[model samples]
Target: MKKTWKRLNLIAAACGILVMSAGQAQAMGLLQAYEAALINDPTYRAAVSENTAGKEFRNIGRSGLLPTLQYVYGSGKNRAEITQPATNFLGQPTGGFAVSNYDYTSITNSLSLRQVLFSLDATARYKQGIAQTNYSDAIFSARSKDLVIRLTTAYADVKFAEDQLDLYHAQRDALDEQRRINARMFEKGEGTKTDMLETQAKLDVAEAQVIEAQDNLLNARNAFSAIVGSEVTQLDGLRAEFTVMPAKQTSFEEWMTVATENNPEIAAAKYSLEAAELEISKAKAGHTPRLDLNAGYNRGLSDSITTRTQDQTIKSIGVQLVIPIYAGGYVNAISAQAVANRDKARADLDSTRNRIAIELRRQFNALQTSLTKISALQKSVNSSTLLVEATKQSVKGGVRINLDVLSSEQQLVAAKRDLAQAKYNYLISFLKLRVAAGTISIDDIQTVAAYFSPMS
Candidate 1:
């Protein structure tokens, strides 16, 4: 039974390995992933479908203002019974009655036309449709730009996760080598038993951290795959040497003005307000009069019982006017409701403006701060590298212990990790700032992509 269990475990492990290998056949670059997402992303596809449907609103609204024509043809059988008083031959009193029966087929055809001459309701609805269509366009534009930001964020997250895992593994390897060194020195009477125990403890902790980092990396990869609709085994990495750029706009006020003018969300909200105003107009129009031109033609064969064998044709044209007197107070109530809704829309527009301003400030400030953070971390990494080497030399000369060397190595690894984190943060902040300003585009993405080199 034990041997059978062992065989099952081995088979399961082999299957997992095979699945992983098949899941990631090639490395995906940022641009390639973005292209794949554009085609495969469900969210973006939904936006496209919504935009397509929204454009039909105009047609629907205009239908009320157009002329309508209809034709009707009907055929049926008709039967009638007639009764009359009977008279005697000499015109004397006659009480008897006579009856006659007749049967025939009747056919009729009609053509009618109605053209609306005036309708406030129809006009308001047409305007509303235009506003709604504009709103849809703005929303689609916002969503399209959001896709770029979302994709870049996911890409950055995966890269950071990979960086974390690599750093942890490096730390683990350093600890493991120190453990071996301590063991050898203790055996040769050059190191103390305490040194060996300490190195072993650090190695154990480093191994646990490595395990956690691996789990994080797996999760990040899964999230990225969900967006790109495919598993990615590798990705491009940031160049070893690159320059950090500064924000172009000098003042926060300038950014705020730009966002107000260019932000798709704000535009959508304004359109919503316009549509709401039109709704108020439409509701009030319910109390107004309507006028239309009406024309019709009719033809009949065997028209009625009295003209059973006669055929007739009639054509008429006239104008119609309709004035609303009362509708159980529905019109007034609906108009008031529309007014309230319009107020709500106004409030929503204001709220959106405030929220956007807050986000714009946060991303702008973060982008500025990241430049300084990256510069500081770069220097820290450089100094940490030198410190690690110096500590190792001191240990070889009997001036420092194994523990000192281990600490210095750990510090160096930490500095490198921090530097990598800062770089990723800077890139994300820069992109987010652009998103907040409503200026994010493919060119911005391409520029960012240029900062990375494909992993060999």
Candidate 2:
């Protein structure tokens, strides 16, 4: 008995060391995962880069309305020889032809400025740029929300996989113990071979389940690593009593109103529609007159064959007007194309609204259903726990077999696993509902993070 006690102590000490080692491994919380994704996620980074580049569109459009100034300079050496039939002032032909040769360097410089005084097309294009910028901002906002949801889901997946593996391990150990008890009883001629064989078979199946669960856990961890851009050995687990709240807005119509106003996809579609409308106006303006203010200065120095070296400077400022007449019906064709595009844009906006509404409804129902399942599963877990204990007591009373106890244990673990999955599903559905409503934010992530205790 003393040696047995000593062996048990050693086993306990080894378990303690394992627990300590596991504790030493750093735990990644939801917020930390989100931060890592923000820095490392290629999709999010691409969205950021697109947003930054999109802001330049406004400047490009505004340039058309602003004054443009340019300066040009030219210098060249010129040599010229002229020969002509000799003709005197007295109008008499000479025996030899008159020849003249000249060589000189010439320089010319000019500065010009042009400012659009009135242009409908330019104004419409500028407005379109503003709308496009707004569209990019909405797209970026949507991507940010998507990142949050993705990271949260991935984190939950890892926790679920871990829980499953742990449950499998526990079940396998319990079955192994039950199998050993049956084997000993059969050797004593008390238990039947059938009972012992049943337990052994169950133990083998449990061992197989553990292997599968381990593989699942590995895959989940690898998926999480892909998102965080690093290998993850451990993560903070959800609290045992994490609460899932119902959505703030209940009715579909109420949620739809919020989504229509706040959803990034809807906003982007609206901006796209506005931009398309402006494009139509710009195309129509192609037939309208344009006015501009122009000013220029020119200076030149050159030696002429008929005159001595001369230098000249000219400065001029005036208003220029341009009236479009006809361009082989090109203007009309473009205007028609713009009108067609505006129709397409309008259709796109409608499509976006319909898509968002469908998603919002789906997520709303999923969240509600998950919440209900979580409640039901919690009660089921409690009942299964009591049943397992009762089965164990029944075995002691010789009314139930060891296989019965093992079956109860399996049911209890299964219930617990389902409950954990339900909870995770509830949380994920809640976040997805927020995403559909275009209201997901870092605050939501922080709230979820509150449910996780750091690895200790």
Candidate 3:
């Protein structure tokens, strides 16, 4: 019984520690989400691994230009038999035959070195390696930027879902109150049956909407957790008076120029094209002569026929030249393929540029439209609030029915929701436009984060 109590105490302490750890994980913000995603996002991690492996291409290409050394050793036992018609010293064949048999062991050792004296293919490959490394770097940069956008968008989605759920709850509560009032009024024989039925129907619809909103919130939270690799019970909300500003560069042409120069996709495509060109050169180099410096030292023991012990050492150094005469059109075919690949790369680059241009314009226009819509919606929210009050006063004066007040309240809530959404869209479009212009950085995220306050 004492031992059981001790074990229970240990388990209780462990549970306390876990609770404390969970409590320490504060509500996540935009920048915090970005930081977590850097370590946790699978797509970004894959890019990091790929970039690390790609760095080896340089060393692989350089190996052809460096000297290589090798040591070789061999041991074997051999048996030989010889038969010959004997010849006399006077150069006349004797009428006799001789036969001999011998068994012997032999050992040999050698050290060899070779260095490329000249090779066009090796040079081209070295250049290609440099280009490939550049391409990898550009691709990693693109992925990093993509991660930032993805995290930010996901964070916004969670916020939007939460807001929608809150709005739905408020709407449901208002309808429930109205339904209760209608029920009491009908019991007193002061309200029509049709009016009570309509109120109950609206209440039921509101309840269904609340459930739908809850499910949406749950899904959004799940997506958020998937990116940050942790459950998020709460997140910071946008400040009440968050401001949206126009992009610094208003001219589309200027933004286009910047995108062309700085976009990682474009840079990667350019590097790929360079590598393809180098591949063509590498293939064409197949027809060129290759020169290599070779040197070796060798030692051998034993004579095969005499079974006599012998030792010899040989040392030699020379240059080897290989001129490719023919290869059944393989070289030409490969060269043609490389040229075609280069053309494809060029086309891809053009396509990427055009796509970026379209994206920039689209995001830019969306941002401009959001700014206008936000301004207009702000006024609409204010006007709707006044209308709700006026309708309530009219109901007190017996000039309007309860339904009119309820309709005004619904309009106010819808207007507020729309305004909130417009603000989020504006911020997102601002970030996306910068991304399209290749100017988005951590500063942008920080700026956006400044507009949010931690949940209380």
Best by TM-score: 2
Error of 1 at 264 (Å): 0.6
lDDT of 2 by residue, 27-86 (tens): 577766666666567787798899999887788778889999999999888888999889
What TM-score fits each model?
A: 0.83, 0.85, 0.84
lDDT tens per residue, model 3, 347-400? 998998889999999998898899889999999999999999999999999998
What's model 3's lDDT at 23? 36
In candidate 2, list every pair of residues with a backbone clash: none
Arrange candidates, best TM-score first.
2, 3, 1
| Least accurate 10 contiguous residues by lDDT in model 1 | 1-10
lDDT of each residue in 1-456, candidate 1, tens digit only: 224324433553554344344555467777677666665578977997998899878887888889999999999998899897876889764898878899999999999999999999999998899899989888887887788778888888888888788778778877887888888889899999999889899889989999999999989888888877778878888888968775678789999998998888999999999999999999999999999999999999987888789999999999999999999999999999999999999999999999999999998888788888888999998999899889989989999877677677777877877887888777787777777788776667777888788986
Candidate 1 wrongly placed segments (more than 4 Å): 1-24, 75-106, 178-205, 302-310, 388-410
Candidate 3 TM-score, C-alpha based: 0.84
- What's the lDDT for all of these models? 0.83, 0.82, 0.83
